[model samples]
Target: MTRRVALGVTGAASAAVMSGCGSSEAGAGGNVKQPEISSPIDMAATQDVPVGGVIKANSGDVTVMISQPAEGTFKAFSSACTHQGCTVNAQNNNIVCPCHSSNFTIEDGSVTGGPAEEPLPQYPVKVDGGRIIVG
Candidate 1:
């Protein structure tokens, strides 16, 4: 009986740990109230990003690139490469896809380098308080 109870508890603990993996969204666990899922999800902090700098942020499951072109001016685009949907990274003044060297302008998501003909989809972004909110 003791061994059966120990196994049951161990299995429950393992299940709990596995369930929490690979998710950033707040969960409605028991008495805790989950945050409302709104259209404009709160993204990165404004102070962490500098003028002419870019940062990668997650809006739920979608990955977005947030750029500061000038002081108080911000822009965001889908980080997925237009060529093959691989996630792109911030490289200097351009967003580059390591998969195929596809480069896009930070100011606007226009493709500056080849292999990708279409530009990254830009997201409407605005600064509120110290956070950059994206929809």
Candidate 2:
């Protein structure tokens, strides 16, 4: 009877601990929950980004840096720096990381200067009906 009681107590404790992992918020392990984008998310309008310029935009909790390298061509990448996960800004046709002084190309998100070795993650972008769609 004592062994049965002990087993029951352990099982209850384990179940209680495991329940927190399935929470709707960020996990206790600091893992962030990415927002589900079932369809292409519209980030900005075509006129919002100028030719030969870059712009920063957000879709839900995701930050994106977009560039118009030519008259109508558009490119987009995750704004988070690969070096230390710091948010980068679009400046002077480059993605500049304020935290580590890393720079990435606006056209391809390739590292142009380091501290950072990996390129920024690229997202699929398309212009549809004067709207910029990203995913």
TM agreement with the true structure for every prediction: 0.69, 0.71
Backbone clash tally for model 2? 0
Q: How many pairs collide in each candidate, listed in order?
A: 0, 0
lDDT of 2 at 83: 76
Cα RMSD to the true fold for all candidates: 11.0, 9.8
Which residue pairs show backbone clashes in model 2? none
Cα lDDT tens digits, model 2, 1-135, are 699999999999999977654333321222323234457899999999989889988877766888998899999887667876666787787888776688998878899897989998888888899999987
- Report lDDT (CA) for all predictions: 0.75, 0.78
Task: Report how far off residue 130 is in candidate 1 (Å).
Answer: 1.2
1-135 per-residue lDDT for model 1 (tens digits) = 699999999999999976654233332111212123348888889987779888877656656888998888999887777776666787776788776688998889899997989998888887899999987
Q: Which candidate is the best by lDDT?
A: 2
Which whole-number lDDT from 0 to 100 does residue 17 have in model 1? 77
